[model samples]
Target: MRIVVTGGMGDLGSRVVRLLVEQGHEAVPASRRTGLDLTTGAGLEAALAGADALVHCADDPSQGDFVTVYGTRRLADAAAARGVHLVHVSIVGIDDHPMAYYRRKLRAEQGIQAAGGPATVLRATQFHSLTAFFARTLTKGPVTFTVGDTAFQPVDTDFVAARLAELALGPRPTAYARATDVAGPDVLSLVEVARLVRAHRGASAPRAIRVPPVGRLMHAYAESRTVPPPGSADVGGRTFAEWLATQPARLTGR
Candidate 1:
């Protein structure tokens, strides 16, 4: 099958494309890098031509609201017109949350559902890379407290890519790949995550302060979201420690 992956040049999208290619599918990566601007529907027609399915991975860094909501609508419309299947990669807990990003994702889901196209929605947890990005940015002079105690199930992006490829070839079903509430294979407070980073990087240990309210919504996520049971098929094997090991080398170009 020929699959067109929007945002194909991005970290997640690139992984999806590579996995599809490895699975013996013709994967066309369409993005601004390839002259396809999903927001305006430019260069899409030619990019999508002869494609059997579309993996909608396009994202707008500054304005996720416009891109996720409207951009998805346009893609859905085009897919319906062409009678192509769509595999939508979404974030977990989008419908239950009211965040701007999450709301836009919900809108995208609605758009795909209403388009009457063969579609599948796969919502996964945050990627380990996202956590590493936060860790790098929020740490300042030996203390990091912005993330608070909120829970996160950070998955390996490669694992997510593989699951997306599988979905692309299978029947359309709304599937949620619940990542192994993946922490360092051990439950840790926000402080601990920071401490681990400091130790790994050979930096001075930073004090981790707990902020009040710490954003209750995030707290709810931390408490409930990272509790997937043992042996669940939805869980991936890579641990947070393994993810962290790769980060320092990648960051330092070592």
Candidate 2:
């Protein structure tokens, strides 16, 4: 099968491409770097010309809805016209989230459904690196400030990528359908996460300070909106600590 992965050079997309290749599939990366620009629809038709499936990992939250929403719609339409299966990765708990990027992601899902094509949307929790970044950011010297009961159930990037590859290789859906949400095996509180991060760098655990949820966004996080409900997701991935151990002591951006 010939699979085209948008943003294939990215951290996630690159992994998808590599796995697809390892599985004996023709994997082509389509991105601005490869002469394919989703925002402008440049090289889109050509990219999907002989593609049996397309994995959409290309998103630009910074560009507002132009790419995240409209760009996705354009790609969906093109894939639909070509009868190519479209696999899109989305975040968990975006149905009523207040975050702008999550809203756009939801809108992108809607667009794919509206295109009336064979598509699969896979929702996964935050990546381990992102979770670590959050832990680092919220920690101040020897203290970590967190909202009411804020916690994260971050998933492994490789795990998510492998699932995307499986979907692309499996039977094409008849229409827009959602795959089971994927997440990590354990849920850790913000403070616990901070402790793990500090310990990764041989630093002492920070004192935890819990504050009110305050505001809709913080409240949403405080309620653990990012985590899927009990028994509501397919949980399989390296634990946060396991993933952290493989990373550099000094963590960088997500």
Candidate 3:
């Protein structure tokens, strides 16, 4: 199968591409870096040409709606035209979230559902790197909080990617199906995660981090609104601590 992975060089997309190759599929990486620009519609049709499936991991968190919502609609249209199956990566708690970014993601998922094409939606919890990003950035300050009041199931990207590839390579489901939720093996407080990270990094002191719930998002997270409901999740085996052990940069707060 000739599969095209949008944002193939990105955080989660790269993992899917790697697995696709390991599984003996032709994984074509479509990204701006590779001259497949989605914004101007340049090289999009060609990149999607001859593709048996498309895994859309393309994202620009900073750009929000422009990249995620509208961009996804465009990709879906193109994929539909070419009769390519699309597998979309989404977050777990997008439907009832208060944040604009989550709203945008929800909109993107809706677009995929309404795309009138062959597609499967896979929703996963937060990635380990997202937590590490805050941890690394907050280390520069005297004290930074990991939103300890909030809780999240931070799954490994490779684990999520493995599921995506399976959906993409195996079969093309009909459009408008409910998404599947994939979460981490364990749920931990942000503070607990920070402490473990600090210990792994071998920090001299604990002056760099704190545990506090500040934003509305955090409040929702604390209430378990940011994750899937109980018994509604497929849990992976790799814990945050296990994933952290393999990442030297993340462990060291780099």
33-101: candidate 3 lDDT, tens digit per residue: 888766666788889989999999998878757778888999988998878899998888888788888
Which residue pairs of candidate 2 clash? none
lDDT tens readout by residue for model 2, 1-254: 99999999999999999999999999999899889988899998789988999999998888999999999999999999989999999999999899889999999999999999999999999999999889889999999999988999999999999999999999999999999999999999989999999999999999999988878999898999999999999999899999999999899887
Please list all clashing residue pairs in model 1, or write none if there are none: 151-222
Which candidate number has the best TM-score? 2
Per-residue CA lDDT of model 1 for 120-210, tens digit only, reads 7777766766655556556687877654465555677787788778877876544222222222233344555566667777877787655
Name model 3 segments beyond 4 Å from true.
135-148, 204-215, 249-254
TM-score of 1: 0.83
Judging by lDDT, tell me the better candidate of 2 and 3: 2
Error of 3 at 218 (Å): 4.3
Count of backbone collisions in candidate 2: 0
Where model 2 places Cα greater than 4 Å from the true spot, the runs are: none
Per-candidate TM-scores read: 0.83, 0.99, 0.88
